[model samples]
Target: MGSLVASRPVYIPLSPCPRLPAPCSSWYSCSPYCLLQILVTFENLAAWGRCLCAVCPSPTTIVTSGASAVVCVWELGMAKGRPRGLHLKQALYGHTQAVTCLAASVTFSLLGTIVSCAGAHLSLWNVNGQSLASITTAWGPEGAITCCCVIEGPAWDTSHVIITGSQDGMVRVSVSWAE
Candidate 1:
C-alpha cells in the first residue's frame, strides 16, 4: 500500500511598502515639489489598486457590486508615468447581485444612478448609495431584464427614466424618479 502525503497551504504576507525601484533622476533629490508629487502619485496608485480589487465585480468590469443590487462608482483618469488613466474615488457597495446596468443623469452629473435586476424586480439607487426607488414588474411574465438605459431632458424639467429590455421579448419603460 502506498502512503498518502499531505501538504499544508502556505501563506505569504504582502509587503506593506511595496514600490517599484527605478533609477533616481537628478530631480528626485533636487526639487522638493517633484518629490511631493511623486509621493502623492505613489499613494494614489496604491489606493487605486486596492480600490479596484475591492470593488470591481470582475476583472473585465471595473465596477463594484453592493447590497440591494447596487454598484458604486469610481472616478478614474490618467496619471503621470502611467500609460493609461486610472480610477480614483471611494467604493460604492449596495447591490445584492451583479450590477446589470449603470447610468448617470445627464441633467445633473452629480445624480448618478445604478440599476440591478433581481428576477423581475429592478432597483434604483442614487450616487450616495441610497435606495431612491424600486419597480417590480409582473412576476414571471415580465422575464429577466437584459439591458437598461437612462434618458434625460433639459435641466428646467428633469426626469429620471429607466428603459429595460427583458428576455420575454418585451421592452418596458419605467420612471425611476423626478429630479
Candidate 2:
C-alpha cells in the first residue's frame, strides 16, 4: 500500500467504558485505504454489548459497523465532521454475539448485501436490514469465527458467497440460503 497519508491518535475516553477505569482492549479501522470510514469498538466489554469489529463492503458512500449483533450504517461524508443529517442511517440486529468481522460485497445493489461473522456464527443481511440467512457452529474445542470476506459469484449469477475463518484454524465457505 502507499505510504500512510495521515496518522492521528484518536482517544475515546473511558467514560463509555462499561467498567470504569478499564482500558479498551482493541480497536480496528474500518476505513479503506482510499475512503475514510470510521467504525471502531471501544472495549471488549460483554456487559452492555460494547465490543465490536467492522468493515466496509465497497469504497462507496455507506460505512457499516457491527457491535453485539447490531450493525450501524453511516454516510461517507459524515466522517469529515459534516452534520448534514443523522450520520447513523440504520442499525440492524440479529447476530447473537459481538460481531468479529464484516464484509460488504461490491455488488451492494438495491439488495444491500453484506456478511458478518461473530463468535462461531455467520450472518447474511440485505439492504433492507433484514437477515437473509445465518449459520452457527456448535460449541467445541474449535474456536469462534474471527474473520470474513465476500466472494462475488459468476457474472451470470446475482447471489454472492461468504468465506470465514475461525479461531480453530478452519476456514468455511457458505452461500446465501435465501437466494
Candidate 3:
C-alpha cells in the first residue's frame, strides 16, 4: 500500500522522526535515486502530519498530501553543488478529511489536474496549485476511497476519465473535461 513515485522526482511518504537531525529512518537507504526531500519543519506547518500519498509531476517537484488535509508542493534545490532538499513551493487546500490518494493528469504539461481522494470525495487541483473542483465518488455509498488514477483524454475526445476504488470493493469511473 505504501510506495514511492518511480518518476524523476521520487516521493517518499514520511512522518517526522525525532532523535535524528534529519527525517530519521533506515528505509532511506533502499531509495538511492531520490535525494530525500524532507519537510523538517516549515512556517506554520508545525504539524506537518504524516505523508499518506504523493506524485511527482515535474522533474524537480512532487505533490504530497495526508493528515494535514492539504496538498503540499515541494521543489528540490541544490546547495554547494549537492542536492540540498525540498522547499515548500506551494500548498493547496479544501479537502475536509485526510487525503489518502493522488493522481496526476498526463495532460499536466498543459496545466493538467491532480486528483486527490479524501473520504468518498475527489478534489481536483491544477498543476498551478489552484483548487479546481470536487466531486463525490459515487451516488451510492462505496466506503472511503483508497486509490485513484487519471486517464488522459484523447485528442478526439476532450474528456478525461478518473477512476477511484475503495475498501468496499467498488470502482467508479467518471469523465471530466476542462471548461
Candidate 4:
C-alpha cells in the first residue's frame, strides 16, 4: 500500500515598499496602495468576521468592511521594522446588507474621507468615527451597488461628486458638500 503525503501551502513575500513609481512624488506615497501593505498578519477573532474590502486612507489607519453590514475602522502601524498589528478603533453601522465596495479620497484636505456602498445604500464617513452623510436608493436586488469612486473637487471647495456602479448596469452620481 502507498503512504499518504501531506500537502502544505507556500508563502511568498511581497516586496512593494522599495518601488516608488513616477507620480508618487507629486501625490506623496499613494502610488503603492498609499504606501500601505499587510506585511504581517495578526489573528482576528471569529467575531471580527471576514474582510470583504479594505483600504488605507493614511499610514496609521485602515478601513475595512466584512461579510456583515457593519464597517470596522482599525489602527495599524509598524515599530522598528516590525508590524504593530491591527487595533479596532470603531464599528460603523447603517447598511442592511454586506458592504461590498469602498473608496477614500486621495486629496490632502480630505485625507480621511471614505465612501462605502452596500445594496442600494451609500454612506460617507471620516476616519475619526463620524458619519458625514448617507443615502439609500430603491434599486431593488438587481441594482445593488458594486463599485464607487470619490472625485474630489478642490482643497477649498467642499462640493464633490461620488460615482457608483450597480449590478443592473446603471451608473449613479451623488454630490456632497458637507464636512
Candidate 5:
C-alpha cells in the first residue's frame, strides 16, 4: 500500500469584530483566481449584520455560508513584480440574514449580479455598485434560498433570468435586470 501525505491548510485571519457577543466570520481569495471578495458577518450597532461587496472584471471565486451575504472588497495588486497585501476597498450591506447564494452574469442587458438571502429576499446590484431593486418574496414566505445560478435565457428571448433553489423544494426563475 502506498503512503498517504497531508498538506498544511492555509490559515488567514479576518478583521476583528468591534463588538463582542456577536460572532464574525470571514473568507477570501488571492491572485490567479480572478475573484477577490470576502464574505464577513459581523454585527455592529448601526447594522445588525453587514456584507462587504465589490465588483471586478469578472468574479471567479466566492466563499459564503448559510444566509450570510458577501462582504468586503479587496483589490490584489502587484508591487515590484510581487503581489502586495490585500486592502479593504469598501463594505456592502443589504441583507438581514446570511447570504445563501449569489451569482453574476453578462448574458442579459445589465443584470450584473443577483444576491439571495436566507430571509427569502433577492437583490439586484448593477455593475456600477448600485442596488437596482430588491424583492421580499423571491421564493415565498416559507422559502429559504439554498442555491442559485445564472444563464442565458431561451434562444428566442433576448434577456436572461436567474434560477434559484430554495428550502421549500421549489425552483424559481426571476428577472434580473432593473427597470
Candidate 6:
C-alpha cells in the first residue's frame, strides 16, 4: 500500500491601507518586487501631483507629476513595507489647471535626471529633487498638457520638447530652453 502525503498552503495579505489617494489614474514599477510609483488625480487643489520617493539605488527610480496626480515607478518583489515619509526633491508648479502628462529621461545608471510635462509646460529636474528649469509651451495654444518626451541628439544635447494633446484633439510641440 502507498502512503498518503499532505500539502501545505501559503497565504499573503492585501494592502492594509489604501496605497493610493483618491482617483489614482496611472502607475508604473521599475523592477519586480522592489520599487513602485503611483499617480493620483484630484480636482481644484494644487492641480498637479508630486513624485513621493525613490527607493534605494538612487536615480534608478523616477517619479513624475501629472495633471491630476503624481506617478511613480513600481517593482515586484518582497514588499519592503510601506514608505513612512517621502522627501520632496523638486516641484514644477506653474500651471493653473491639472498637469496631464510626465516623462523621464532614459537613465544610463542609478544617478540621472528626469524631465516632466505638465499641461503645456516642461520642467527639468535633478535626482536630488531640484527643479533645474521650467518652460511654457511655445508651439501650441494650450489649456492642458497631455504628454511629453525628451529627445537626445548626436552631440548629447537633449532637446526638451513637449507634445501636448489638447481636449480639442490638437497636438502641439514646444521646445524648452531648460534642455
Which residue runs does candidate 3 get wrong by more than 4 Å? 1-46, 78-82, 139-142, 154-158
Candidate RMSDs in Å, in order, are: 15.7, 12.3, 10.4, 9.5, 14.6, 14.8
Per-residue alpha-carbon lDDT of candidate 3 for residues 1-179, written as tens digits (9 for 90 to 100) = 12223334446655554544554443454332335554233233345577888898766667889998888878766566544457788788888889999998764665478899888889987778877789876544457898999887665565668888987899888888777
- Top model number, TM-score: 4
Q: Would you give me the overall lDDT of model 5?
A: 0.50
Clashes of 2: 1
Candidate 2 lDDT over residue span 19-72, tens digit each: 433343323322322223444322322332553665665443454444556777
* Alpha-carbon TM-score of each model against the true structure: 0.51, 0.62, 0.67, 0.72, 0.51, 0.42
Which has the better lDDT: candidate 3, or candidate 6?
3
Task: Return whichever of 2 and 6 wins on TM-score.
Answer: 2
Worst 10 residues of 1 by lDDT: 31-40
Q: What is the C-alpha lDDT profile of model 1 across 1-179, one tens digit per residue? A: 11223344443333332242433223333221222222122123332223221233222223433233434355434347332333533354443454545544543245655555555667766656567777666567458676666776655544567888887888998875545
Q: After superposition, how far is residue 9 of candidate 1 from its true place, in Å?
A: 37
Candidate 6: stretches off by over 4 Å: 1-59, 66-97, 108-113, 138-142, 177-179
Worst 10 residues of 2 by lDDT: 26-35
Least accurate stretch of 10 residues (summed lDDT) in model 5? 39-48
| Candidate 5 colliding pairs | 51-71, 52-71, 52-72, 52-92, 67-98, 67-99, 68-98, 68-99, 69-99
Give the poorly placed runs of model 5, Cα more than 4 Å off.
1-70, 78-83, 106-111, 138-142, 152-159
Better of 1 and 3 by lDDT: 3
Worst 10 residues of 3 by lDDT: 1-10
lDDT of 1: 0.49
Can you write out model 5's per-residue Cα lDDT over 1-179, one digit (the tens) per residue? 11223334445555544442334333233222223333332223123234423233343322233324544433444466543344444345677767656665543234445354455887666544567667865545568776766666655554547777877888888765346
| Candidate 6's TM-score | 0.42
Best candidate according to lDDT: 3
